[model samples]
Target: MVSTSTTGVLVLLGAPLGNPEDASPRLRTELARADVIAAEDTRRLRRLLSELEVVPGAVITSYFEANEAGKTTALLERLHDGKRVAIITDGGMPSVSDPGFRLVKAAVDAGIPITCAPGASAVTTALALSGMPCDRFCFEGFAPRKDGERRRLFTELAEEKRTMVFFESPRRVTDTLRAMAAVFGDDRPAALCRELTKTHEEVRRGGLAALAEGAEADPPRGEITLVVSGWTGPAASEATPEAMAAAVAALEATGTDRKIAMKTVALRFGVSRRDVYEAVLKAD
Candidate 1:
């Protein structure tokens, strides 16, 4: 379907996250004109085209994580044969916790020109809707499936000052929330974005501990994006003994035991629990 002789080019296409109208005219044209189209799921591509009412004119083939390595070579051969190839995923951009990295790298190494037709991304979409600071943020793809690894990862990022974005499955969403509350503190502000850009889209914003409890009470369904507020870092003046004692006192007032409150305060501030304990005792 490609009319031009221009070849040896790889195009990365960004599929709509949910809404069919989000598909761009450029994407439609490319889908109809590319020499060959590599898709994460050919059936999903067909469905998307059906919804968009734009049947692809090019040959469509699967290029998912399982077989990307093998297909990249074949795809590069097509490119070398003066064919235009476009790569698309079921949702959002490719290689962001998805397939296509291998092909992109191979294309680049082979001097095959690479370009992109950017579109909706759940990462940015959720970040925008999360009501959290977006100026500085990090997308942590997906959390570890193992509890220990996930918690260790959370512990490592506990002091990260940049707002964090994470993808989670509905099944483990509650567990992830609980782990987040444990590592980042129960009072940390967070948002659970579910089924983003879809009819059943929902965004629940609250303290991590409360969200954990709510997820426990009623498990969520659909794709999930968890956005948590970042540590703002210690104030320039640093927390004095008085400030540390006051923080523990505030937690105690909220029914947290005095000893537990002191430890919580220390973890939240990246300070010593012993120091917090001493501060609390002196205040008493």
Candidate 2:
């Protein structure tokens, strides 16, 4: 250990989200000087250090979600003993959606000096490429995995005017997007950013329904970021049954499955599923 900690310090370093080169100089310096590296995944951090080619003199320790409640006090004890500990998650900034929040809260309550290494984030990456406004946006992280909770999340954000960013897994992308389309709308402009900053990086921009259907047919692998456009107030025809049917048809026009379309129409217009289904059938 370099003993850079005559005064204890905790630095939350942002690991590279995808491309290894995304590591920042500040991150390198922090990792180099940290007496203890509290990382979510020790092996991933090791690979990152190898990629950066910076051999740290610090002791590496694991600090992920599973053991955070137990490790918070121990890590705080190290800090209290005047050790400089650096925390890093697998990717993106720690404490954002990762395991560093509890530790950060503990340190702050104890009057510990805490700082961060700003680097690549899927939130910002997807937002910039999403062709959506970023000047004022909110990162919702990952929505709940369960359908009911996820639906409530979408409902809460249904009226959010600021551009929204979300992290989703591969297998659940379609389901999540379907829920988003339901609460937000089939015509709500959105983008699906996959494998950002990697070899097979792709950005598919369209309505939520379009991306959901496409991704369902060909499920995207690796990380998925959904940058959905802000609420636009009922898509011009929210007042009539015929208009709702037309909107559903438009969503279907973009290759969204009928079931997904029904979900969207039913939720967005605050109508029953049976009503939306009958309307779509009448349209046919």
Candidate 3:
């Protein structure tokens, strides 16, 4: 067992998504000075350390999805014993669709100090590279693997106004895009980002239908992140007359002519132009 006199602090370091040069100076210090380092993949951690040219002075242990629950106790014990416990994942932030969540929660419950060295995040990286509106967005993590569950989830988010970000396997990328086109409308704008931060990185942008067709022709490989534009159609349910009118106004503000905007919004809400005209008067 490694021994140290340093006060225990649970440090979560954001490991490089792809490039080793992305490792921060603080990450190197923590790795070298830690009493115990919990890594999602010990082999990858070793490789990263070798690449970064930093030999850790800490004992290393594997802590991944399968062993995270089991390793929590040992890590917490080390922390409680006043040993600095540093957590690093294969890539990106810990506990973000990665391991280290249980350890962090345990540390917090035990009143142990918790800190982080923020680094590369595939979610943010993909969003920035997607060329989509990033002002308001939500990360959906990985989609449900099963077709039924995935479809249901997509259906639920059909009216979501915030841009949606999702992580999907390369094998399922084409299928997921096709399914999204079915539920979210074929013309909804979207971007498919694959192999981010790597030499073969590719970002394909277009409407959902077009993207689906492109993915069919050229299958994507490596890590994938998908960004789908939010719903801008007429409010579906519980939409007040005023709300429907406001929706039309919003469309018109986007350089769409008012008559066309009203007609489009009316069709979206499954209502007639006369109904939308009445709602507009009410809004006024």
Best candidate, TM-score-wise? 2
Worst 10 residues of 1 by lDDT: 249-258
Q: What lDDT score belongs to each candidate, Candidate 1 first?
A: 0.85, 0.84, 0.84
- Residue-level lDDT of model 2, residues 50-148, one tens digit each, is 988899999998999899999999999999999999999988888988899999999999988988878888888888899988888988989898876
TM-score of each: 0.83, 0.84, 0.80
RMSDs, each prediction? 5.7, 5.3, 8.9
Candidate 3, TM-score vs. the true structure? Answer: 0.80
Candidate 3 structure quality by residue, lDDT tens digits, 32-148:
989999999999999999998898889999999998999999999999789999999988999998998899889888888899999999998988887878999999999888766
- Candidate 1 vs 3: which has more TM-score: 1
Native-to-model Cα distance after best TM-score fit, residue 146 in candidate 1, in Å = 1.5
- Candidate 1, 1-284: lDDT as tens digits: 85565556788999998888999998898888898999999998999989878867788999999999999889989998988999999889988888899988888888778989999999999999999999999989899998767766776787788999999999998888877876666678999998888899999999998998999898889889999999876553445788788777655554446776666667667688898888888998
**CA deviation > 4 Å runs, candidate 1:** 1-7, 234-267, 273-284
Best by lDDT: 1
In model 3, residue pairs whose N, Cα or C atoms come closer than 3 Å (at least 3 residues apart or on different chains), thus clashing, are: none
Ranking by lDDT: 1, 3, 2
